[model samples]
Target: MTTLNALHQLDLDHHIHPFTNLAGHQSRGPLLIDHGDGPFVVDAQDNRYFECVSGLWSAGLGFSEHRLADVAYAQMKRLPYYHSFTHKAHSPGIELAAKLVELTPETLNHVFYTNSGSEAVDTAVKMVWYVNNALGRRGKKTFLARRLGYHGSTVASGSLTGLARVHDDFDLPAIPVRHLTTPNYGKEARPNETEVEFTTRLGQEMQELISHEGAGTIAAFIGEPVMGAGGVLPPPVGYWTMVQRICKEHDILLVLDEVITGFGRMGRMFGLEYYGITPDILVLSKQLTSSYQSLGAVIVSDELHDVLVRQSAQHGSFGHGFTNTGHPVATAVALETLRIIETEDLVANAEARGAQLRAGLTLLEDHAAVLSSRGAGFLGAVELVPDGPAGAAGLKAFEIAHKHGLILRAVGDALVFCPPLISSEAQIDQMLAALRLVLDDCA
Candidate 1:
């Protein structure tokens, strides 16, 4: 039998963790999560922790959701696996696509499935290029992203992502892409500048970049309505509006990466609705199946969909798909996940709980080690005062919070929070209480 130490040794020898420093991981070891309940998880040693990060900003239905488990089992028994390729289709996949179309904005009516957000992003890039080629716009191949934006980690998607870590040493940005300024008013906006002024400046900056690159060469501008993994920064007012207008004027497509903010994280069915901005392509994952299963989708606009259809008719076929393009089991789980989100009204719950969380964190703005607090909906972050370097203080705070029975993430000094959508008012209070104790102890 595998003892705990044996399991640890096995992991240390074989496991290659993502987004981790390998040497440091070998030294520190892994946190073995044995089980979970509601919004909390228990380690192998029976240590319980409030899941403040919602399992990498997914798991909206929380841990131990039997509904999702049962659905998976039922689907497995009925039709465990099937492929949607060569004009073949399945009910779960077809129904899920229809449901997503119904839930999203009107123009976004077509859904293309992938197994993860990374693949969805890559697919969106390919679709943009394909549509441009179909329109005889061969020169429009460049992609515009923002300095801190995160799309995914695939070769092309990583190129679209603007974070340096996603690029460093990977020799990425393998494609022709340019990154613009992040619309983080708290960090980037100048002193005494109004929100309008900031928005205009960023818009002008984007326009300038477009002009520098020649608008004919740029294919699309991809961004997150609420930039996640980049410190949970919410867009400033008028940011998305100006960006959308710019895309229209330049004839560049607008691709919103909703991998982190989709499925009711932003107090709306979609983050685009929350900001009142539309997009040409919508990349989705993470919460689509509430992370119960691996599934993703790229929802395209009617205009682009028509172009792709024409392209396919002109050529022999579209020539793009995966082995599990719309795996029956994954889609079935996603269908049930959507039902739960809608039936439970978790979107509204996120709004209410987000308000409570923001209020509680705002009170910490005066703390000696806290720099500021900012968030929207159930997603939020508290920037810690840098002790010496940027991540130093935040790292300490994160360790303290863990000791206080909370699981939190520190992206540099900005500690991000994304609790499950099903969290009760009392659970939210408990999260805040844990944070308070950690802050006091650290202070």
Candidate 2:
């Protein structure tokens, strides 16, 4: 067995982790995660931590799932690898696509596979352009996104992401991508502005941008139903509905980035369903495979799909695919993962436990350090105010929570919590209790 120190050295010497401070991590050494059981993961020294972020908000079934292992192993034994190109197909891919079509919004009838969320978003961008081009609207090339909204990290997707940190030094926003204000009532709301008024104003802002840029120049407007990496800001009431209406009025394609909110994370299979809005294009990833495998998909409306098919036929081929676009092993695991979510009634569990979690965390609203507690289903965040000279109170709280046996992530001044969908009532209580203790200690 490799020693902890040896593993740390190896990681420091070679592995470059995403969203990490490389030099700081190299000096402090990485957290050597050894294994996981249920909702808990153990470090190299066997210290268990409640994985509140669910392994970067993807491990929907949590860790230590024997069924996923069995599915992956069986698929490996049968057929380890294959490509989905030139009409080639596999059983798992076909089945998963059918199930996804069934589960997604009624309008999203066709699915295009990708190896990751970034690839899926890139593909969606291409599809939108292709569709517009096919319809003879070549000037409708601009894409509109919301400020602080995150899509993915590939070239086109990264440009679509509105986070400054994601664009710094990258020379991004490369193409015709524009951003509207984030609909964060807590931070963006004006004094005396009600949630409904804020929603109206946000819609007006979108309309203003569209008018200024000329709606005919814009191809699509992309947004997350609930802004995830932008600090878990669920839209105020009537936000999505009005946005959808605006898009329809302007003939703009609406692309919902459901990377974080899809597959029952928001107590619905799709965020669009929860928000009661349908989109021309929908992007899905993260929990689709429950982190059991790396896979993502872009579900298109029938109209868009028809245009894409015609365009591709005219062009000879689509000219977009990854080597592992629909890897059999990943698809097999995803198929089984979806089955587990269905059979275990995990979506219902997420709804129930999410209520418990919200209730428990809301009790901390009076805590001097906590500014707000907001959540939808199992995804939530606690915004904090800076204490003392440093504006690192949220980061400090994150460290304190980790030391107290819960893994939490910080987005600016917010403590983000997205536990596994299978998290039990006791685990929810444990998570809150850990936070309470950490807050008390920090105070």
> Which prediction has the highest TM-score against the true structure?
1
Instruction: Tell me the TM-score of each prediction against the true structure.
Output: 0.99, 0.98
Number of the top lDDT candidate: 1
Per-residue lDDT for 237-296 in model 1, tens only?
889889999999999999999999999999988899899879999999999998999999
| Regions more than 4 Å wrong, model 1 | none
Clashing pairs in model 1? Answer: none
In candidate 2, residue 217 scores what lDDT? 98
Per residue, candidate 2 scores C-alpha lDDT tens digits across 255-292 of 88999888888887777778998888888888988878
Error of 2 at 75 (Å): 0.6
Distance from true position, residue 420, model 2, in Å? 0.4
